[model samples]
Target: MKNKLKEIFYAGLIILVALTLGLAPVTQKEIFSLKWKNLGLQLVEAGVIDQEKFENLYTARGGLSESDKEMLYGRNNRDFKITPENSGMALHMLWAFGLANKNPILEDGPMMDPRYGGAENFASTGGWTLAKGSTMDHYSMHSFVTLTDDEQALVEKVSKGIFRPCCKNSTFFPDCNHGMAMLGLLELMASQGATEDEMNQKAQEVNSLWFPQVEKKSAGCAA
Candidate 1:
């Protein structure tokens, strides 16, 4: 009986190890890639992100790391990889891009719904204080990454399915920072000819990083 019990214990231990490995969270992998050549420079030049204010925000949060500085100020020809360490900066970068980029989603979509009292009233709009003027001044005002008609349709369709942990609304109705940042990401992906599956995959990866606490709870529950 003792030998039989030992065998069962070892078997259960092995099974537990395997399960733990299987459910390990993907926290360090490259979540998404952007051909981010001078896009950050463009945003600063357009005054959508005041360089001083932008830098100050990060300074208060332990200052921007050298890599973060490069992404925002340097003309990086290399594909920008989004990892957990820099996801916060990426969020703001994409938020600025999403907010400033002229797209029908911001101009004509649910953001403009008559019941919202105006697009400027939402956190996604009013919370962005880094702009040169009122956040509304840059709202959908720049043609940074213009999408073709078909591409725009893809963005619209995909945005409807993507929701942030901060809110229940889909990216189609970007009332908060996460939703707006995601909208920016989806637009960039679509403009670069990313397929629907690729967009969805990247979105999930990025969202996990953006909301790590929620992801941790989810992983724990699964394990």
Candidate 2:
């Protein structure tokens, strides 16, 4: 009887181990879906991002794939997925979106606080060099995704809670590129009617992709 019980326990343990191993890849393959259509093309046409400079920046780093190019220059009718491979590109594009999109958060939020000197002084604005003109020229200048008053409030509320590993400031401040990109993503998600829970979940997933090494270490500790 003792021997039989030991065999049953070991067999159960082996099955559990196999199940965990099998599910690990599926969990790691998580993707963030966004209602991205012509937003990328709009960014290019609006001079928020000079196509030549944007292409050159990626060309030196092994060029944009066909799917990436379509997202930038063509009408991507499908919902965009932020995969590990495209997360870096998504970061820059969303940075441009957040920087250029006309929103009260950028105009009246913490970025414009008198203590910061000016909005251009921060990396989120000054650090972007791909614009057709001075980065400030395109700063909060376009209405790519006009949010309702409620949606705007939702964005502000959620942005306050989402912070990147690189900085202590929340996305509401957007002093860095990561913060700005997050702000852009929040606005886009809110505009598309994403609930607060969805916003938080996608934000976490995107952050994991943006800072994979940090996430890996954090995951290791948790495990």
Candidate 3:
């Protein structure tokens, strides 16, 4: 009986995961009311988010440089880490988006690559209209992101790696998926005030891809 029970449990788990990924159309049809909560849960299911993975993404992006400083966007040099406690809910919402068969081309892109527009990018373009009607409130979910100090440092790095110094300053807003998400978070954080520990922590997150450390000549004014 114990063995049978175990098998049943495993089968049930598999079914749940499948349904999570498969029934996206049905699941997403009712996302507006809850918004961020729905997104956070979905991000948890997709490999794209979670505490550890979020931190790793920041680390993977590297740090800022000289040329990065020359640009308006790269000047911020602050941290906007993607921590589980903060951006978890938002990312889960993003996960459900790509699965919804909306913009398969852009929705399902490389998370680490700035050019690889994902749910965040789609939200920047269609979150309010195109994507909103089909799935969760993409804008609200993106706004739900919250980052920790360490994660902010990671954001500084990743922002530089993908967003580039010439892009939008290494701050949270990059005019893409992450960018929109960053903007949403900023709006949410605004009420908390810039002096707040978390908001202040964001100021230090820098991926200065334009500073003296980097060979600016390589992509000088590439944008």
Q: What is every candidate's alpha-carbon RMSD to the true fold? A: 6.3, 5.5, 20.0
**What tens digits encode model 3's per-residue C-alpha lDDT throughout 66-143?**
322111123232333333222433432333333331221222233325674444344444432323243334322332
Highest-TM-score candidate: 2
Model 1 spans > 4 angstroms off: 1-27, 215-223
lDDT, residue 63, model 1: 94
Q: Estimate, for each residue in 18-54, the C-alpha lDDT of model 1 and write its tens digit.
A: 7788863444667789788888989999999999999
Worst 10 residues of 1 by lDDT: 214-223
The superposed Cα distance between candidate 2 and the true structure at residue 53, in angstroms, equals 0.6
* TM-scores for every candidate against the unseen true structure: 0.84, 0.85, 0.26
Model 2 clash pairs? none
Show the lowest summed lDDT stretch of 10 residues, model 3.
27-36
| Tens-digit lDDT track of model 2 for 81-121 | 88988888889989999999999989999999998799999
The CA lDDT at 207 in model 3 is: 17
Q: How big is the RMSD of model 3?
A: 20.0
